[model samples]
Structure formats: C-alpha cells, structure tokens
Target chain A: MSWMHTIFALILLPAIATGMFRILRGPTAADRMMTAQLFGTCGVAILLLLSTGMGNPVLLDIALVFALLAALATITFVRRTWHGSNKRNHGNPL
Target chain B: MIYSILTLFDIILILTMLWLAWCLLNTEDIFKAVVLFISFGLLMALAWVRMRAPDVALAEAALGAGLTGPLFLSALRRMNRTRKGERRLDSDENREKEHKANQEQG
Candidate 1:
C-alpha cells in the first residue's frame, strides 16, 4: 500500500516490455529461449510487487512455483539440444 | 513523507531494469546476450526485494538467474557445434572438388 511499492511496480512495466521485445525479435532459438527466461523473471518480479502492494502472502507461493517451472523448462531444452546435436553428428559423420 | 525514500528506490530499480533491457536487446553475441539476460533476472530479484517481496527474490535468484541461464548457454553451445560441422562439411566438399580437378589435369 506504500507509494514506494506503487512506483516500483510502474517502473517494472517498461523494463518488462523491453524484455518482451527481445523475446519476440531474437534471431536465434537460443536467444528466444533466453528472452523467455527473462520474461519469467520479470513476471515473478511483477507478482512480488503486486503481493507487497496488496499485502497478500499467497502470491509468494505462486512466484515460487513459477520459478521452479521456468528452471525445469530451461533444463529440458538444454538436454534436448544436446541430444539433438549428438544424433545429427552420429548420422552425418561430421 | 515517509514514502519519498521508497519512491527514490523505485526509480533506481526502474532505471537498472531499463539498462538490462537494453543490453538484452542490443547485445551482438548470443552467449553474451544470455549472460545479460541472467543478470537482468538477478536485478529483477533485487527489485522484488526492494519492493518487500523476499520470497520472490529468493525464487528468482535460484531458478531464473541461477539455473535457467546456464541451461540456455549449454544448449546454445550444442547448437553452435552443429552449425560449425555443416560449415566444415562444406569446406571439405570444396577441397575434394579441387583435388579431383588437379588429378585430372596431371
């Protein structure tokens, strides 16, 4: 409920927007993945800012879950890329 | 009155976030871009803390910046190798063509 929290929330908006642009415009798939991760990070920050502004504790749990899922998805992508390259190399002899 | 300091903190956080956004958008190399993205995550965590959300800060640091960044980088490295291999193959084929031409002439 503090003015400080409100101001912080407002500031985060444009930053989040910029990150979203990167997500949309990234040249490589990996760059897009990184941008998506940025989105997740910013989303968590937004939720936290809202939780503080609203004096609610429940949003903390949501943020925690989001973070876990984001990390898991990233790791999965990494594993898939590794396996994909390995398969390509095996078949092509290059 | 008391909120004035909070407002200042908010402005500072916002500026930092914007700087991060610029880096994420303009970085030339994918690897460096990924690193900047991770740093952006950490800065967002700090922003969350300044906003009084310690739980979110902890989660962002652990998952977003810590675990996710490296995962992406590793994946990028793997993908880079495949591209490199294709280029190598192309060069090899070119070399083979040159060798055949030389043998024919000799």
Candidate 2:
C-alpha cells in the first residue's frame, strides 16, 4: 500500500470515533439515525480507500455492495420512521 | 511510520468499539441503544478491513449495521405504540372505576 492511500484511510478513523459520541448522547431518534447514516458513508469511503490502497479490485466490489445496502437501509429507515403503515389504515399511523 | 500508524489505528478502533458497546448496553433509551449498536457494527466492519478481510467487512456492514439498525428501531417504535395503547386502556379503566365509585357514594 502506498503512503497516500494509507494516509487517506487512516484519516477516517478519528472521524468515526467522533461520530460515536453523537450515537451515545443524541437526544432524538432522528439525531442518532443521522449519525448512523454518517457511519455508512464513512464506511464506504474507508472501504474505497482500502481497495485502492491494497490494489485489490475485489475490495471495490465490496464497497459497491456496501453503498447499495446502505442506501437500502436508509430507505427502510425513512419508510418505517416517517411513512409507516399508517397510510393504509385511514391515515392513522401508530 | 506507517506500521506505527496502523497499530495506532488498531488500538483506537478497538477502543471505540468497546466504548460504543458499553454505551449501547447501558443507555436507558432503546433508540439510543440501537444507534450505538449500529455504530459499533460499522467500527467492527472497519476493523475487519484493517485486518485485510473485505469479505467479512462487507457482511458486517450489510447485515450487522445497515440491515439490523433500522429493524431494531422499527421494533422499538412498535413497542412504544403498544405501551401507549396500554396506557390508554389503563386510563379508561381508571375512569370507569371512578364512575362506579361515585355512583356508590351518591
């Protein structure tokens, strides 16, 4: 792995560590959820860095999978948290 | 220098995971716990990558963090709804009891 890639990947660790505080202390579900989203994005970035740093194309594929899954997860969150099964029951959401 | 940096990263990642796990386990709020658990999953995935295991990292991100986090939150919301329903029922029962007591007194 080249120094540049190593540096790039190393930078994300502190960022992730910082995100943990919000997860621990967030006042609302939405705040915590946003930090969770941050994790997905940061994970994607770190994986990309690792793929390029290690010169392994397979890691890129893994990162792509993470990206897709992360989007799906976020969509699931939005659907459940905001648009839950309420619309079907005469607009009364529980 | 890179070796030292990587080792330092390993330490930080592990510590972060431990602290997040503690927070997840100790929080009174279920929603906060779910979020911390998800963050812990992400950190574990990163640790996998550091160990040169992209396959494990991929699985961790998909199943551990991404998929599980929202499911936990939704389940919590459902629990909240049930608790609210129980509270409403309890309040109605109390009202009925009060009515009965007033009728006996009168």
Candidate 3:
C-alpha cells in the first residue's frame, strides 16, 4: 500500500519534467507564469502522495500552503507585471 | 523492492531540482528567470517533504514560491520603469542640446 502511494508520486514526476520544457522556451511571460501554476498544482499532488506514503500528516499542511500560494503568485504577475506592459498595446490607461 | 523504488524516486527528484536551478539562473529573460525560480521553489518544497522536513517544506512553499515570486516580479517592473525613465531623460537632454545648436547656427 505504501509502495502504491510512492509509485503514484513517481508517476507525476514526468509531468512536472515536461512542464519545465514549457518554462524553458515559453515565448510570452504569461506562458511561463502558467507553467509555474502547473508546477504548483503538481507539487501539491506529489506532496500529498509522499505524505501518505511516509505516514507524515504534516505534509498535508504543506500541500495546503502550496495551494494557497499558487494563486497568489499568478495574481501578482497579472496585476503588477503583466498589466503595466499591456498598457501601450491598448493605447489607454488601465 | 520498495526501498529501491524510493531511492530511484529520490535520485530523479534531486536531478530535476538541479536542472531547474540551472535553467532559472541562466535564462536570458528576467521574467522567464523569475517564473522558473517560482517552480524551482515548489520542487524544493517537495524535496523537503521527501527529506522528512515538513516544517521547512511549509516555509519553502509559502515564502519561496509565494512571496518571493511576486516580490521579484514587482522588482522587475520597477527596474524597467527606471530604465525607461533614464532613456527619456537622455532624449530630453539631447533635444535641448540640438535646440541650442540650431539657434547658434541660425
């Protein structure tokens, strides 16, 4: 049973790896931000699997923290970084 | 069998983290580098969990991925603004110099 949890966690590793390629070559800042979002979701899943496999309930809290913060990063990117750059494109103040 | 499987997982996780750090540090674009940094922090948190350090993992996820990412993004914006401001000042100085030269020539 423990092995199952670990195995499941191992399976998610490839998805994260593939996502890194997007981060490496993503043309737009938004693409890179979206990839980071993917990382947050996958990290949470991996943490949950490891928590169960190792029988450490504390990891669930870490997973919760990850979930809460992922959105925060994306919101900051859109509001502060992305919004300013797009002002010229619209030719109006946002 | 399970022990060996866990070891394999650990090895892969370590390798991935190293690769992420490498990419984040060397990327040409500041925005890409910052985004890569956020993901690297997320992986680092996972590594902390694997190492049986839940407290560290919680801190890493919250500060490393969450707070630091936005902090860097805002800093990048500030940097770009200052750069634009400097360029504008330079152009204004150049225009003043040109006007003085034209008056003297006329």
Candidate 4:
C-alpha cells in the first residue's frame, strides 16, 4: 500500500520534468508563466501524495498554501508588467 | 522490485534537479531564469518528499516556488524602469550640453 503511494508520486514527476523542458525552451514570457502554473498544480499533487504516503497531515496544509498562492505570480506579472507600464503609454502627466 | 523502483525514482529526481539548476544558471534570459528557478523549487519540494521531509517541502512549494516567481518578474520590471530612467537622464544631460554649445556659438 505504501509502495503504491510512493509509485504514484514517482510517476507524476515526469510530467513536471517535461514542464521544465518548456521552461528551458520557452520563447515567450507567457510560456514560462504557464510552465510555472504547471509547477504549482503538480507540486500540490505531489505534496498530497507524499502527505498520505507518509501519514503526515501537515503536508495537506502546505498543499493548500500552494493552491492559494499559485496565482500570485500571475497577479504580480499583470500588475507590474501590464498596469505599471501603462503609465508611460498614457503620457505620464507628472 | 519496490526498492529498485525507489532507487530509480531517486536517481531521476536528482538528475532532474541538477539539470534544472544548470539550465537556470546558464539560461541567457532573465525571465527564463526566473521560470527555471521556480521549477527548481518545485522539484526540490519533490526531493524533500522522497527524503521524508514534509515541512521543508511545504515551505519550498509555497514560499520558494509560489511567491518567488512573481517577485523575480517584478524585480525584472523594476530593473527595466530604472534603466530607462537612467537613459533619459543621460539624454537630458546631452541635450543641455548641446543647448549650451549652440548658445555659445551664437
């Protein structure tokens, strides 16, 4: 049973590894962002698997935190790159 | 069989980590580097799991990969803005210098 859980977690790693290739070879910023998004989701899944396999509940909270903050990078990207750059485009009045 | 599988998994995880870290350091673009860095964190979290360290995995997933990706992007933006500001300052100084030269000639 425990080995099953371990194998499950181990199997998911290849997906993340593929995502790393995307990050390495990405031509656009958005591609990289998408890959990071993959990281968040996959990380959560891996954490859940480990948590259950090890019979440690604390890992669940970490997974929850991962889910919550997953979009934080996107938010910052939008605010800093898109919104902040617009200031210069509108002809900075100041 | 299970031990062999576990050993194989550990080998792959270690190789993936080393590959990602190398790519992160060698990548030319700062944005790509940031992305790789996040991936590194996430992979590190996986390694923590294999090593039976849940606490470290949690922190790596949340603070390391999650928050830090955006932080690096913003830092890149801040750098560009400052670079632009410096260029503008240099151009303004050049304009002033040219203006003074014109006045003296006239």
Best by TM-score: 3
Sorted into a CAPRI-style docking class, model 4 comes out as medium
| Candidate 4 lDDT by residue in tens digits, B1-106 | 6566678788988988998889889877877787788778878877887787878877887788777777888778878777875333236776798689889999
Best model number under DockQ: 3
Between which residue pairs do clashes occur in model 3?
none
lDDT: worst 10-residue window of model 4 chain A: A85-94
State fnat for each of the candidate structures.
0.00, 0.58, 0.79, 0.73
Clash number by candidate, in order: 0, 0, 0, 0
TM-score for every candidate vs. truth? 0.45, 0.78, 0.85, 0.79
Rank candidates, lDDT, best first. Answer: 3, 4, 2, 1
TM-scores for chain A over all candidates: 0.79, 0.81, 0.89, 0.83
Model 1: residues >4 Å from true position, as ranges? Answer: A81-86, A91-94, B1-106
Per-residue error for A61 in candidate 2, Å, reads 1.6
lDDT of 3 by residue, B1-106 (tens): 6687688888988998889888878877888888888888888888888787888888888898899999999889878866864332236776798689889999
Which tens-of-lDDT digit does each residue in A1-94 have in candidate 4?
Answer: 3667768878897888877777777776777788888878987897788676666778788888788988888788767765676566547744
The TM-score that candidate 4 achieves is 0.79
Residue B50 of candidate 3: its Cα lDDT?
A: 77
Ranking by DockQ: 3, 4, 2, 1
Error of 1 at A19 (Å): 1.5
Pairs in clash, predicted candidate 2: none
